[model samples]
Target: MKILLIDNASLTPVNSALCCEPKTGEFAKELQALGNEVTMYGQIVESENIHAFNIQENGINVVGHHRRKLKIFNYILLYLLIIPQIFKSDFIYIFYPSAFKYISILCFIFNKPYGLYVRGEMGLKNGVSSFIYKKAYKVFTVTDYFTTLINSLSKSNIAETIRPMINLNEKDIMPVNKKNISGIFKVLFLARLEEDKGVKEILYAIYKLKKMDYNLKLILVGDGGYKKEAMHIIDKLDISDFVELKGAIYDIDKVKNMYLDSNVYILPTYHEGFPRTLYEAMIFGTPIITTFVGGIPYLMRDKFNCVQIKVKSVESIVNALIYSINNHEKMLDYAKNAQTTVKPIINSTRLSHAEALHNAIHNI
Candidate 1:
């Protein structure tokens, strides 16, 4: 099968770590390994239109387009450039939202089959997404909630849930040190420092914990538009000493090291489809404390694989942290269980990738 992957809107050059790119790249690699031809087209936002090669280092071809802006005229230009390439493929797989309604209509005008991967929260925006959902042949979402939402909106029975997959390996798995425990437990919050991510709530929880004389270290990773506001909250609460914002962590190895070093991971995100960070933390054997929002409950169980907290409650988080610290053995067990749960799902191997793709293809 010849597959063409389209990532037109989200192919921002600002994505240095290529957080979103890896999954699509992995899919392309898997398809190529199965003796299929795969090509990925990424659109980069730029000042002037320029063609560039984003080398597919792992058995796929990646083409990039640099456009001045995402205005209507540029979008039209992008559509014109990408439509022909998309038509050339046997199958088309679109990631995120695409100008695909226009391109897909063209493809349909020529009788083509295309698939869409909705990795973001659906139904948040109005008419635009509803139209795309209706037109797609196969719609893949990261969570069941989103799948149901898309199904309801589109009135299409073709929606399926495919959780985000990561490259996990035996080498990546460190020795499970049950005996080793942190004297001052390090709690990590690895997400964008934004209001929607609940960073303020995390800081407040830490502050409350400190008021109760709990000695804990909180590390906040990732940079976002809300850095100043989060910092102000930290200052207002006078908990700067307890909390440290480490900014955007680009290196995967460095991120893995953070996971391995920390005793517990907390993500109090207000909304998420299925966060990759949660899986990343779980795979590294760190106990997770995340809110019961979106598809989080699908992966984590209260007191089993992870501790699920309620949204926007500082007391709840502090209580969970205290409980996790007191029941060290239970926390370790939960961490181990988390690792076990995710290992089989996201192991990084050609065989596993082939199997996942085969299942998806067969089901679709």
Candidate 2:
């Protein structure tokens, strides 16, 4: 089987150095290991009409177009260049549904069937993405909410909810002996720094916790356009020392260690499909305090696996933080339950995505 992996999700500006999507590369590599020939459509910052070998070292062929400052003529030229590659493959698997809005039309013209994976929200700019979903062979979304939304919009029964398979290694997992979360508590927030992500609310929550005389350090990771705004909040609240904005740590090992080093993880996001960060934090046995939004409730229980906070509520965040701190033993229990809940689903290497892809392709 020849598989064409389309990773159209743009990386945050902070992740510019890394050329390949980690999950897509891992998924494609797994497919290739299963004896399928896989080719990736990479997202590179290029100036001219060009193609670069992105993951050739990993045994996957890549052909990509320049993403930054791309004009209408550039897209036209890129479409022409990529059309032949689409013709060469037996199946097309797209990472982002909106990306297929235009490419799916080309696939339709060439009589090629493609499967779309919805990571988060859709591009409903012209209401044509619904039409694209309708034409797709399969629609795989990370959350049940997305599956239902796509099925309703496309009027197609092909939508399936496949869990986001996190790629964790033996080295990435902290040993049981080293997994103690006692002493000066360190809270970690790993997500894109944006208004909707609830970064400002998190900062205020940290301030409240500090005022309560809790010895804790809040670390904010990842980057976006809202960095300055978030920084302003931290400075204005006079809790700069309590919060550390690490920006985006591109090093994979560093990210894994960041989770391991922290005692708690929080994502007060206004919206999310299924946060991969929570999954990682759970796998690392870090207690999570997140808002009840999207598919998060499907995985995290109110007091079973995590502390459920209300979306866009600073008071809720502060209360959850206090509760977690006060009930340290129960917090650890929730963290343990979280790790147990996620262990069965995470595939690390040969992800469940492989099985999902296989089923989607053969079931047709």
Report the C-alpha lDDT of model 1 over 1-364, residue by residue, as the tens digit.
6677776344435334221345555666777877778777755543211112233445576566666554787767777787777767777777655454456566566666777777665343468677766777777777677778889988878787664555665456664435355567789988767788988888998999999888898999876668888889999999998997887775679888888888889988887778889878877778888898877777678998889888888778888999988888898888888878777556554345334445555433
Q: Local distance difference test, per candidate?
A: 0.72, 0.75
Off by over 4 Å in 2: 11-18, 46-54, 68-81, 123-130, 148-157, 169-182, 247-256, 347-351, 362-364
Q: Which stretches of candidate 1 lie over 4 Å from their true place?
A: 12-20, 29-37, 42-81, 97-110, 124-164, 169-182, 227-238, 248-252, 347-364
Give residue 262's lDDT in candidate 1 (0 to 100). Answer: 86
Worst 10 residues of 1 by lDDT: 46-55
Who wins the TM-score comparison? Answer: 2
- 44-147, model 2: which lDDT tens digit per residue? 55321112223666777777656646566666776777788898989888776444358878888898998887776646323677877888898888877778
- Tell me how far the alpha carbon of residue 106 in candidate 1 is from the true structure, in angstroms, after superposition: 5.1
